[model samples]
Target: MSVYLFFEKKLPFREKKRKVVRWIQYVIEKEGKKSKRINIITTGDREIIKLNKKFLGRSYRTDVISFPMNGGIEIEGEIYISLDTVTENAIQWGVTTREEWRRVVIHGILHLIGYLDNNRDEQRIMKEKEDYYLERFPE
Candidate 1:
C-alpha cells in the first residue's frame, strides 16, 4: 500500500508524514484489506477555500476535504487538508498542532470508508468515528 503525502507548506513537525501513512495502513488492515493506495494533499487556507467552493459549493473554509477514487474493494482517493485551519482549530480546541492534524487526517480517512456528514446525525457518527480513531492512534 502506498500513502503519499503532498504538502504546500513545510512538512508537519509533530507527526511525521510516515506516521500518517502508517495510520492509513492500520485502517486498511482493520478493514480486511491487504493493500490500498491513498494520497494526501495539504495546502493553505486559500487553496482549501477555493476547493470548498468549487467542489462542495460552499464559500466557507474547511479543515479537510476528501475525493474518493471508486467505491470498490481497493481503496483509492485524495485527501486535501488545510494546515491553516488545523493550526487555528488546534489553538481553539486547546490541542497541539499535531493532534488537530491527526484528527483531520482520520476524518478524511473515515470519509473514504463511507462516513457521511451531510446531516447532523451523520456528522455525529462521523465525529465519533474520528474520535475513536484519534484515541486509537495518539501521539
Candidate 2:
C-alpha cells in the first residue's frame, strides 16, 4: 500500500488534516476496497487550473482532479485538489470548508472507482455517491 500526499497550497486548517485522512480511509473501506495504494496531492487554484487544462482539456479552476495510473481495479491513482476552490465552493455552497473538502475527496475517490463525470447521468450518479459517502463519514 502506497499513499503519497503532496501539498502546494497551505491548508486553511492544519488540525483537520488527520481527520481528512481518516475519512478518506473510511470511504475506501466502506467501498470494500482492500488495496490501500492511493496518492493525494493538494495544490492551489493555479496549479489545479493548469492540470484541468492539461488533463481534462478545460481551462477552469476545479476543486479536485483524479488521474488513474493503470485503469485497473487496484486503485492506483493520483488526486489533485485545489484548496482555494474548496474554500470558495464552501462559501458558495453554504457549507463549511471541511465539508466541501470532504465532498471533493469523495468525488475523487469515486472517480478512482470508475465513476465518470463526463455525462449528465454519470455526473448525477457520482454526486449521489459522494453525498452518500460523505454522510457516512465520521465526524
Candidate 3:
C-alpha cells in the first residue's frame, strides 16, 4: 500500500506529513481494505471550486472531494482537498488547522471505502467514524 500527498499551494506545516500517511494507512486497515494507491492533493479554494463544478456539477467550494478509481479488492482513489476551505472551517469550528485537515482527509478516505454522507443517517455514521478515528490518531 502506498499513499502520496501533493501540495498545489503553500504547504501548511512541516510536521504533519508522516502522521497523515500513517493515519491513512490505519484507516484503510481498520476498514478491512488494502490500498494499492491513494493520492491526496491539497490545493486552494479556487481549484477545488473548479473541480467541484467540473466533476460534480456543483458550483460551490467544498472542503474535500474524492474520486474512487477502482472497486475491486484493493482501494485506489484520489482525494482533493482545499486548504483555504479547511482553514476557514477550522477557525469556524474552533479547531486547529491540522485537526480540521485531518478530519477532511479521513472523510475522503471514508468515501473511498464506500462510506457516504448523502443522507442524515449516513452523515451521522460517517461523523461517528471520523471521531472514532480522530480520537485514536497520534498527535
Candidate 4:
C-alpha cells in the first residue's frame, strides 16, 4: 500500500514527501483501513476545473475531488486537489495555506474511505472529523 503525490502545477507550499505519505497512511490506519494506493495530485484551477467538468459535470474549481478505484475494504483511489482553489480558500477562511491544504487533502482522503458531505449535517460531521484529524497531524 502506498500514497503518491504528483504536482500537476506548482503549489503555494511544499510538503516533505515522506511526511505527507506517512500522515496519509496514518489516517487510513486510524480509520481501521488499508490502501492499495492513493494518488494525490496537486493541480491548478484549470486542470481541476476540467476534471470537475469531465467527471463531476461541474464547470467550476473545487478544493479537492476523489475517485475511488476499488470497492473492497482496502482503499485505492485518485484525489485531485486544486492548489489554486485551496490557496484562495485559505485566505477566505483566514487560515494558513498549509492548514487549508491539509484540510482539503484530509477531506479527499475521507471521501475515499466512504465519508460523505452531501448534506449540511453530513458536512458538519465531515468537518468535525477533519478537524479531529488535523489536530493530531504531525506538526
Clashing pairs in 3: none
All candidates: TM-score:
0.88, 0.85, 0.95, 0.95
What are the lDDT scores of the predictions, listed in order? 0.82, 0.80, 0.92, 0.90
Give the TM-score (vs. native) of candidate 1.
0.88
- Clashing residue pairs in candidate 2 (N, C-alpha, C atoms within 3 angstroms): none
Residue 16's lDDT within candidate 1 is 69
Clashes of 1: 0
How do the residues 1-139 of candidate 3 rate in per-residue lDDT, one tens digit apiece?
Answer: 9999998976576647787799899989989999999999999999999999999999999999999998766899999999999999999999988889889999999999889999999999999999999998887
Q: What is the lDDT, from 0 to 100, of the residue 101 in candidate 2?
A: 78
Cα deviation at 107, candidate 2, in Å, is 0.6
Better of 2 and 3 by lDDT: 3
lDDT of 1 at 137: 79
Off by over 4 Å in 3: none
Q: Per-residue lDDT tens digits of candidate 2, residues 1-139? A: 4565667776776545566667777776677664347788888899998999998799889889998766554677889999998999999989988788778878988888778888999999988888888888766
Better of 1 and 4 by lDDT: 4
For residues 1-139, what per-residue lDDT tens digits would candidate 1 score against the true structure?
8889888876467456677788778876775553367888989899999999999899999899998886666777889999999999999999988888888988888777667899999999878877877887734
Whose lDDT is greatest here? 3
Name the better of 3 and 4 by lDDT: 3
